[model samples]
Target chain A: MSITRITVLSGGMGGARFLQGLLHGIAAGTVPGVSPGAEVTVVANTADDLWMHGLKICPDLDTVMYTLGDGIDLDRGWGRRDETWSVKAELAAYGVEPTWFGLGDRDIATHVVRTQMLDAGYPLSAVTEALCRRWQPGVRLLPMSDDRVETHVAIADEAAPSGRRVVHFQEYWVRLRAEVPAESVIVVGLDASSPAPGVLEAIAEADLVVLPPSNPVVSVGTILGVPGVREALRTTAAPVVGLSPVVGGSHVRGMAHQMLTSIGVEVSAAAVGLHYGDRATTSEGVLDAWLVDERDADQVDRVRGAGLACAAVPLMMSDVDATAAMAAAAVALVTDRGSVDGAR
Target chain B: MSITRITVLSGGMGGARFLQGLLHGIAAGTVPGVSPGAEVTVVANTADDLWMHGLKICPDLDTVMYTLGDGIDLDRGWGRRDETWSVKAELAAYGVEPTWFGLGDRDIATHVVRTQMLDAGYPLSAVTEALCRRWQPGVRLLPMSDDRVETHVAIADEAAPSGRRVVHFQEYWVRLRAEVPAESVIVVGLDASSPAPGVLEAIAEADLVVLPPSNPVVSVGTILGVPGVREALRTTAAPVVGLSPVVGGSHVRGMAHQMLTSIGVEVSAAAVGLHYGDRATTSEGVLDAWLVDERDADQVDRVRGAGLACAAVPLMMSDVDATAAMAAAAVALVTDRGSVDGAR
Candidate 1:
């Protein structure tokens, strides 16, 4: 099928980067069979969201919005561009807890607007839509779920403050730097959450589904954990292709190795591709094709042997052009081998 | 009586300035008989407080805290010193309403901390106290009432779709600049709101109670409008004395004239004194004495003619010493003639 409608299951930084390249590709008419008029829908993971100091903060959704809208702090790769730290400093001075997270002043404006809307009886999905009227991220951006779903990391605590502390994902990643081993990744409230408005519909109506090299466990993985999402992928007539976040034996960025280890998944491209499995082999499985970096070429045959069309390409998104090339490769991989007949 | 506990029913700017000078007087041992260790307990008006963008902003309470803690913007006489306006600008950029309030970046920190605590099931008074632990305002600061009480102004709207407009006190004062004629000053929920913890107790145990030269109608007047507060003042053994915010037939600062005019009280020093009324004459009266500025000294006798001892003093609070001198004159006004016999 000619690429027209594309849906991406996304996380924060890595997912945002891929979407940027994909948008660039669409705009430049360079993303394989995809044209400039192609509509992209991003279903961002809200499992990474947390309420801090009474403000609802959606790191993944904001990342996709700010990054795509050209408002992201380029250096930080998460918060707003030209952000100030006055609010954060004042918060620290007041000795409010969880001071490790750097909440930029410019970023806080988004939170204030969001929190106000939420308090006024608007759900998270509606709030995101209202906020997007400003950012104009181009693509239809929808949160994974309107219900509160927080990713908590279980870690061994020798201090025994609570025997073993299950910290919020941010505290684990930002504060602890994911240095300590995580026993498990707990996605609280995700199992009970229904897909947010337009989420399942976006997936169902899409020509293709792309999983950019986001954290398989926390980012894209948690998004899949939401009920009806994985089911939509299984039931959709469109092809589903994924680019491996795991390059060679580790993540290009972030602590995917730590998270994968915690979740009892192997830290390799082939292992991750197999973990997603083949739609032909398992009725519950969703992947039709998987792309890995050139360095992981040796694992391509192994990934293919598991009943999914697998390809090795240069997947480092150094810039928009390079990332667009990766996106193009992803589109070509799915189009060539993940066509309607290729499902067999 | 050795003045140990001093309670002041205060508004924002004017009350804050008066308290600053009062503290200075106490520190210098110059307020008639008040010593260095004199403890001040301020009952601040919560009527001016509003929930903006999901944050509880206590203008008067914050004014007292910021002023006493030396964090206030001296030039603006409100908000934190050396403040940035990034949040305010961002809010405006997002097209959030009532952007005229000028919430400083540093000042927004106060609101955030307050909002967080309030969301976490703490009362406004507790949140204020928790926030004060940082500023160390050196006085017991109590919100006039823990309950929500908003001062809304009724305005004539000849051109309105509804033919009338009722705005929050901030909307009237900050946005409108109180330029439009206020039809009535309505203290919503005031009659239903009981005094906050330590409010009535602070009044009952005080050697002296002061009505700082804040906006008498909206600020101090609103605090007295709280259910138990006015009754506490009427029954307390402490001499209840007030200083005139009006000078030279006009307010020294702020919109006292407009609010007084809205409530049908004359916008003059003597009229304000009589408006509080003679404590001995009426069962509901609350003020034992009133002081006018030197500019309105001629009206002092007219105030005394209303069955209360009155005095004229320099009230411009131009500097700490001048303000301390004014505070001294106020203390002396109540101590000398507003003693037990003065009530009779």
Candidate 2:
């Protein structure tokens, strides 16, 4: 029996939670157990990392990292648990510029080491590797790019000092609370930065690709910005599966509704499925199967009409066990497809 | 009737400790009770700042800042008092490089913000200014230069692969415990870096200049490496005074004896006095007056023979009050000189 390697493209909290469930499911021997154990690869988004007070902060990557490595602050949804703030207070006393962002003391040690390594000319992947040695995130976590690519939002603030401010994703989410209307979203440095080492290979060789209930526009979308990433997904023989972040016209977490509206996509699972339509479905891109919640069963044919395999199931990942069940369902769908292909 | 401005050329621990006493003495009305208060400008060494655990740790400046701002760790001799080590434990768990240097959770915050600001394009001087605003050390403290000048010690290693090695100052001090005999020391990056803002004016206008009892080979030597700093000290008309760091043949703190030996200077007040010599005393280099401990009173003629106005006082700053008394004596020497110059 050959190993079935599962590849996941993830963002922050939601994706991390789902991956946790997937890992749990694998451990419980539920999700189509593969011989020689299952290999998991997480291609993470670095778009959310912003330089605040001179430290590189990647919210999404760290979330997935801490969650998988068992170092995450589950209560805060970001940073490490049992963190301190001595350095923050000291910095505050210095009246250092850009004092808005709060860096915890324990959290600061990580940033200090990361910044130090970066200054010493280590790439983000190598630094990530060095950091992950302790967390052992259970899977190989790769940043979309070793180079910097910050996500920026263009706001129509005609009255402001800068007619349009290009704020980093973190400033939009963490500082501004996503209150300002985004006229356009831009991922800076995408044109220059290539995908990290082994990223495309992992995606290409995976038995199945999973896009855990992450924000399609920023989370998965930013990962797609990496050169060769989306192309690998489109051309891979493996079936691609995505769990909808939208449930009952609302996001599970974060201000995904505003982001969806900014990109002209409706805040619905059907719209989300259509947004990532089958290459054959709407001449948009590639997506083999689209899964929605049981509540949105009425939108099943609409999803099928988009020219892809569609399924409506209990998609609420209520707990670790439930999340594994969701992952199991997706795996079952891909396995069923594999058998059909084998017969052909 | 007018406020007198005092400028001091400082090294690290001893210099900073002396400043602490100077402040205390002035506060207690021990130093010529002038109205509108006295202003002090401290030109500090950048040589001791090392890139440890990937942080630009300026031991001297931070010592002065913490000491004056009332945050100095009383027992540790470096870093803030009451700092936690949870971050250090975590960093160690990750098997981070340079594990020997202890960066407390509280201290790590300072490094994080400093690294961040440095990445964002602010010069070290501006960064120091911002840092001092919080510490409010009550003195205008400035780095000798905005340039990167790392002190590297050339060591003759016999037990290993290479017979000779250039180790960073911290590696030599903290890691190797300075037991390894040093061949020579190099202040890297000093050739291009300029003296920080306000350094020259402070020296030119100063009524008195004092070289605090810091390490002559590295701490003060590094400051002199900045192109114009030594020249400014050389041409200043104010009487220059220095308290000897080497007392009765032993360093009060640190491995100054080892450093002095490496630099080919004997660990004695007489050798340090002659090292500064008449060039620092007669017309322009550093001073007209030199203060040695009462134990070295026999060397008064020896110092005077080198063309410096010499005085032998009980120079042991054993306590805060004693330190203040020492500072008062330095001021009295300067005042007497100024009065004599006025008569001329």
Candidate 3:
């Protein structure tokens, strides 16, 4: 039987770009040298969506939406191109409460509509689907949770003895530029939020699960925070393959290195794999395969030592062709092995 | 007795500009011979302030604020100059609701603060005061009422035989551009909305009352709709003078002609004086003094015929000098009569 469904666990820019390339590759039927009909499903992080200026902003979701809809500002890597700010400037003059985060004019329209629809009783999953209908992002996009789950960082400040205060992820990432080292990272409302509709179903039904090189902590970690999500990943019959976000010892973008250090994890593919260790240390089994950059070939044994099968590949998604090679490698890892438990 | 205070009945744009010139001329002690320390209180029309894009946009108030604060876009004559629209563009791409009217970025910041403060339990009058503190729009700006008194136009549509549907003034003004002739005009909530703080006091204790050449029907008329305001204008121990918005047979700005026609009043200075006709037509009494444009000099007796002392003067308000000259003329009209009614 031919491999059909593919589920991608993605974060923001890096993950979105990778998925764009992957979708392109898949559409061209050259991703993994496979035939057409590879249904792509992406579980996007929703922890970055925040209400600012009386607008409901879903940063990650919008990034994905705009990127896929051909509306993304290629230069900014976020928000729409040719956007206006007549509204925001006016709001500032009125002495609006929070003048911190910047919300573009075109971006505000999205939030207003999303907020209106959500307020009118549509579940987030349904709303995402409805929004996707307009963009036709090609691949099915799913928010990690139908309910609210915000990622917050604990930072040291003079106000607390621990010098710590919790800030929304965007406040830490965008506003503060992640200057203050975080003591801990917490995904708020995780305990109550359920996996978005079709999320687990997509994971369980996929022939292969691909973890794009997104920020491992906030993106993938936030996704797994949803109830039944980690459980599904562990028990799903499909083999899971993850690309390392860390090519060397630093993140491709953002302040992920500081985030990794804050969480007491070394910025390395080996450390990341170990964090999601195999059955020996995990209540649930680890990833069946982890793709590491050729530069880190010497560290593959560390991943193998953790009982995770490791492959050293030129995992650098330098271009569309290069990204397709990486995606094909991921599919090959699962297809060549048939199945994690030899079920195939 | 020294002339201690000045009360001005005003509308947006034209009224605001005229007020700015008057304020400048009075403050610099250059008004073709007028008293110094003449306190100016502007009774601003709140009829055009509508809730759009979740913002309480007061066109009249913002006009006065921007003009007086030296932030007004002289070219556009509304909103700030050098504004951005990154937020609005983003909002549009996201398919936000209510994308009809444009809101600028700088403009939006003002709304955001206003909305937040309003949500935080501050009344609009206090909010306007706080906002003015930043712009320092010089004169005390008082809304006609603290309540939600919106100007609605009865439009004829296929939905009704009378084609009569009451819409917010902004919707009629900005959205439709007043293409449809108004069947009737309704200032909703005015019946219950009491005059804002300082409104009655400002009119009751003024040395001279000047009605800026604003839209008589929507602006000044809306102010008159507020309870006790008309009475104060009639019985105040000061002269109430009005400079007509209409010159000859045309309004300087807006669809004032259509609005005037809705109330069955011809679009002329003489007609506007009759619309504010003395106690015979309005218990609030008519103009104690009326100033007509040189082009409408022939209509001075027509205004006088409406039971008010009238003066044919140059009321073009081309600049500070001209506006100050016109203001002096209005004061002279009242001063020459030497107390039309001693009871007032």
Candidate 4:
């Protein structure tokens, strides 16, 4: 298949990194089935979106935009490269709440513009498109939903605090550092929200869909939790493949371990593949193939047994070439399976 | 009579500067008939308020806070000292509107805080009090009204590409530099606006009332334009005095000349004094006395002929001592007149 249109279901750091490498591969004509002229569309999770000091901030969308636009701070792996914290400092001096979140001075421009557009009756999807005009992140980025959908982490609160025990995903990840055991992840407002404009269309028309090494539970999970997105992934004619965020026994990076533990999934690559299930046989499942790290080659048989086409590859996205190689491996796995199915 | 509570109707830069000098004079006990520990309440003009980049910015309110809190940039006469412009630069890069407004990185915090509070169901007056907890701007700062009241300038625009030829006050002052002829000043929504919670009460309870050398057509004018504010000034038992913003044939500073001409009033000290009218005699007028600069001393007889107790003093606010002397001259004029009334 000539994969001229590629769709990526993404999170923040991990997804942004993978998309960067995938873009580099396409530019180098190295990602299998994907031509250098391929058009990429990113369906970003907005469950992590927050309203701070009256500005709407979408962490995942901004991370992807900044990273791909070459404006990201390489050291911090997020936010603007030469960002200042003058606004942050002043906000603190004023003793405003939720000072823990990182809102850099340069990054604040994105929020200000987005918030202004939102206030002027533009949908979140259109606002995101307007923002990308400046970043030119090389892909069409659409938010998961125009309506609010926040991920809340329900944690055991022995301290008897005044507010609800279930805190915002940001308070869990950024403030608490996910120290306490999470009871469960609650995808608030997801049950009522329809997908944002062009989200399901991108999924249905894609040459192939790939789930990058993002948190399957929160990042990808929250996107899937939106009513029509998961259904689109399951019913689309295009093949679907996922790269394991879990390498050997841990996530490549981020809170995947804590999230998986909360959802009662084992902390292994095979377990993650099985958690997604197989798209070919399972009635409502959404995975066609799964890629694991080379060190987790032992899990390939276990993953295959779960009715998924499985491949083991070096999956650490340390650099563009290495991550592109991993992207190439995932494409090869799904395409090879397609060929075998055709022959059968 | 002891001047225990003083209320001042003020604009942004000039009014704030005058308030600072007044506070200094009160603290030094240089102003006669006033004690060192007097409570000051400032009724600030809100007509210059603008919703730019989706944040509600009150230029006058912030100027008062920044100046009195010792956080203002002395050279610029407004905004936070040691401010950065990273947000402004980034916004310009994004091509957002109102690129001319100088929203410094540090100053953006105040807007952000105020906007958030306004969004969260708090009135502007309440929000100001909450902000005052941080800056401690000394005097009680009450917005002219809780309801929205924007000042619009109708200017000659035979070449306007969009909308009415009328523009916002900021646009007229900053963008057009007031070079074009202004037809009239419109205080939109002022008729429907009630004074913010403490505004009328401040005037009614004040031991003395002074109108600082602020723009009479917009700053002080707009506040008086609010439905109940003008009535309060007319009925208050406290002696009302005003310092002429117009120094010689032109304004001491700001766009008072253009504004005066817009309303068909002569741009002179005596003209401005008569425009306020004589509160002691005129049944509905709002000023009992008016002060002119030593340079405009020649117009003292002209002002007295208009039924106001006229005084000539050096009105140059060269420094704290000079400005405090101005404040002293203003208070002495009102108190001396009050003693004559008492003897009668």
Candidate 5:
């Protein structure tokens, strides 16, 4: 079963890094079953999108584009390499709000172009395509949905009458540094959002689908929340597999632990795999196989008990080579299942 | 005849430099007949304004604000000092249009704030005020009008059926470098534009009105083209005086020569002075006195013969001190006239 078409659900940073390694593995013909010259399509989460300084900013989409195009600031893991923060500083000097977001000068150019196109009646998907022409990130990048779907987190605020205050996910993550306790995660407009053009089709037609180690709650979870996206993944003639964002009892990166906790899910590898669940047993599940880190190898039986083909591997994306090996392991684990009946 | 309140109709660069000197002279009490702490109000031309990259750019207003606030790039006489071109370079890399106009990163902040405010339904005057809070450009700065007034130049284009092509004033000046012969100058929406709030009152209540050495046809001319602006100057009791942008049969700086020629006015100090004419002699004129460059002293009589007091002085803004002396010379020339009968 040579996987000729691969689709990935992605967020920023970690997902971008994973995709870089995945593409590297495919180019080197090192992935277990992916065919040579196989195409990859990314359905990136847009719930992290925001409007600042009157410019539309899609963090996840830009991260993927810049990372794959070799423009990512390697140290920061996001934003353009050699980026200058003149606009951000100037905006701060003007005493404008949200001075915490480090909007780089080069990055603002992307936002400006996107905002102008959006203002001119181009949908988010079309704007992403237009912007990709400049990055040429090698794979087709599509927003999970063209419609606005912002993630809002409710945090404890004694000053509020309701004893809670809701802030945009960015304000929670970027501004507050996600240190405060989140009471709940509200994905505004998520349920109403239809998947962007070609999103469902990409998933249904793909030979295999891999979910990178992104923040499952806000990133991959938001993508699946889009109407018909989960159904497409369930009904597709493809092996559906996911790598655990959690290692041990905490997320490797990002605020996934806090988010997962806020949603009442245990911040553990076995728990996240079971949360995504086994498509064979439950109608709500979408994963046929799930891979956890070697450190969490002790929990493999717990996930396999839930009807998912489970495996443990070194999940750290320390370098391209290491991440590529992880991708190979994920593919080999799902392909070794020998049938797509569970994915169906 | 101590001038306590002064109003100046200004453009970019040259006008800003002149205002700097004028302020210096007023602050240092070097002017012949000006009271201490005299307030200046500038009615800057917005006809040369253009919207590029979906950002509203008022070059002349920004020039005045940045110059007076000491944030201007002194060498370039415009934009923020220590500016970075990251945004501009990134935009060009994205193949966005209007690459000719240099939108510096720090300068873009001003535009972003202004654009955001404008989109929020704030008028240009209010937006200008909001921006000025940061720059603290001492003098009160006001746009000629809140209404959109664009200056378009018709240049000889043989490829067109009409043998002429109309372009934005910025495109004509910056992109084309004004190399092509301009057939006509059109100030779109000028006739319909009412003076911005406080514009008419500033002119009417001023004790002295100075027209700086800016482009006569485009800058000052555009301000005069506003519906009630010229009438306010014509009916105001304040004595109106102007400095010749042209000197020694050519303009000292800027494309005043090309602009004058396009408007069928000779590019000579005396011709520009006479073109403004003596307010006493014609109901259409707006200058009671006009000053020419020392090099054009021979043409002073040509201007004096047009029923206006005329003088020749060192008009080059070589330094702040030299420019202050020129301002002093202008004030003295008007103050020596004694009677305000011609001005009225």
Candidate 6:
């Protein structure tokens, strides 16, 4: 079966990097059963969105757009390539709060445009579409939901009356560096947020769906927490597959290990796959197959025992070619499983 | 008489340059009969204020602040000295409107702070005061009024249905370059605006009031149009003096000639002085003494005949020292005229 339409659930840096490789593999006709001309749709997590200095910032959406559009700062893995920080420095000089989050000058233009449109009553999805007109990020990028969904993390605080305090995910991740132990992950407004326009439709109409190696707890997990999003994934006719963010019991980049730990999920490749679960057995399951790294081959059977078709390949995305090979392996894994008869 | 508390009604570039010299002259003790430690208060014209790209831009206020705070671009005579145009370039690439107004990265920081404060329910005066905490622009800079006041110019547009078009002051000045013939000047909200906090008290308690070499019609005239502001000036106990922005047969800089023509005033030093009129004769007059330029020395007698003390001096603001000499000349002209007891 040839897949011409593919949908991917994404986060920031990790998801953006994975999409680049996937697109490269498809263009090179190396992703086993996928068409070279496949139309990719990205439903990105908005839980990491923030408002700073009165401007709305969508970190993940901008990451994907800038990365694919060749405007990303390659060294930093974010922001504009040749960005200036005059505005950020000036804001700090003014002694405003949250000076830790650096907003680049070139990036501020995007936020100004978005804030203006959002203030003028355009939804986040529409604003994203309008912004995409400039970046033309190759894929159809839609926010997970139009309503505000912020990820808040509860961390133990010795001085607090309750012995714990909740902080915005950006405060925890960007400011605090996610070093402190988090008591729980609280996704405010996620359960109440409806899927943004075209989100559910993209999933239901896709030939296949792939979950990139984004942060499972706050990224892909937050998207699934949106009302009707998990149900759409569970019932979609297309086969669903995912590559492990974890390899040898730890994430390669980002604070995914810390986030998973906060949500009480084990920091292991097999545990992450099992956490997503198998679509054939449970109503909550969404993935048809799970791909792990070669170093974690020992845990492949443990994931397979949960009724998910599992395989181990070289999942290290060192470069484009290497990541493309990982994408190819992921596609071949699902193709080799030979279609779960009654699941679809 | 040692005049200590000096109040000046000002506009943008010309006014800002004049204030620099006035302060310099006061510090150097070059101005005749003026205290070395005199406190200067600037009542800036807010009629040229504009809202662009969802940011409130007060051109005159920012010009005065940047110039006084040493952040101004000396070459351009406005904006920050080492400004970058990344945000402006990106905004142009985004294809948003009003691309004519170039907002630099450093300058946008000021607008961002101001916009954020204004959106949070603070009035323009309070926002300006808060911003001055950073700039510390020596003088107590106050907008003429806290109310929204915009200067609109009616230009003869043959293509318009009514054979004319009314454009914002910035559109006329910046975009159109103020080359076209202006039919009239209309100040929206000026009539309804009350003087900003401390504005009336500054005028009433001032030891001397100086109208700098700014655009007489749009800048000083707009402030005078604010109901109680003119009354305060007319009834103040201090001597009121003004320097001619016009020299010879035209204005030294800016589109003052075109603005004067729009209001049916002749573009000559003598006419501008007479337009302000002598405070001793008419209830409408606000000037106790008017100083014309040396180039227009022949017109000095014409102004003196209008029952006001008038003199001729070099009015060109070639540099700080030259402008300081001009400020001293203005101060000496008023001192030589002697006091008009009943008028004060």
List TM-score per model, in order: 0.96, 0.89, 0.90, 0.96, 0.97, 0.96
Pairs of residues clashing in candidate 4: none
Give stretches of model 3 more than 4 Å off. Answer: A33-35, A82-102, A119-123, A159-162, A279-281, A337-344, B32-35, B84-102, B158-162, B279-282, B337-344
Error of 4 at A191 (Å): 1.9
Model 2 lDDT tens row, B1-344: 23377788887678888998888887788865333378888999988787666667787888888888888897776788889887787677767766888677667667766766786788888878878877899999998887788899999977658788888887898899888788889778888888888898898888777887888888887887788877787888766778888778877675888899987888888778777656554443456667777777777778778887666667777777888877776666555545322221
- How many angstroms is residue B14 displaced in model 3 relative to the true structure, after the best TM-score fit? 2.3
lDDT of 5 at B242: 95
Ranked by DockQ, top first: 5, 6, 4, 1, 2, 3
Return the TM-score for candidate 4, rounded to 2 decimals. Answer: 0.96
lDDT of 2 by residue, A48-138 (tens): 8877666677778788988988888888877888887776676666665556666776676677668768878998988888888878888
Error of 6 at B45 (Å): 1.1
Candidate 1 residues B159-245, lDDT tens each? 899788899999999989999899998888988898999999999999999998988889988988888888899999998888888
Error of 5 at B182 (Å): 0.4
Candidate closer to the true structure by TM-score (higher is better), 5 or 6 = 5
Put down candidate 3 lDDT per residue, B1-344, tens digits, no spaces.
45668898888887887887787777777653356667788888988887765567788887887788888888778887786766565556556655666676676666666766776788888888988888988888887777888889998887876657888888888888888999899888888889999999999999888888888888988898788888888888787888878887888775788899999998888888877876544565647777778788888777777778787777776787787766666666677644322211
Q: What are the RMSDs of all candidates, in order?
A: 3.1, 4.3, 4.0, 3.2, 2.9, 3.1
Which digits, one per residue and each the tens of the lDDT, describe model 6 over residues B244-309? 999888888767789999888999998998899888898799998888888888887788899878
What lDDT tens digits, residue by residue, belong to model 4 across residues A213-316? Answer: 89999899889889988889999998899999998798878666889999999989998888888977887678989888888988888988989888787889
Off by over 4 Å in 1: A161-163, A337-344, B337-344
Clashing pairs in 2: A54-B116, A84-A105, A93-B134, B234-B284, B280-B287, B281-B287
| Model 4 lDDT per residue over B1-344, tens place | 89999999999999999999999999999988999999999999998999889889999999999999999999999899999999999999899877888899999999999999999999999999999999898899999988899999988766787534888999998889888888888888988888999899999999999999999989999988888888899989999999999887888776678899988899999999888888767765799899898888889889989899888888988898899988988988888755322221
Index of the highest-DockQ prediction? 5
Between the candidate structures 3 and 4, which one is better when assessed by DockQ?
4
lDDT of 5 by residue, B59-165 (tens): 99999999999999998878999999999999999999979997999999999999999999999999999999998888999999999999999998889999888
Best by TM-score: 5
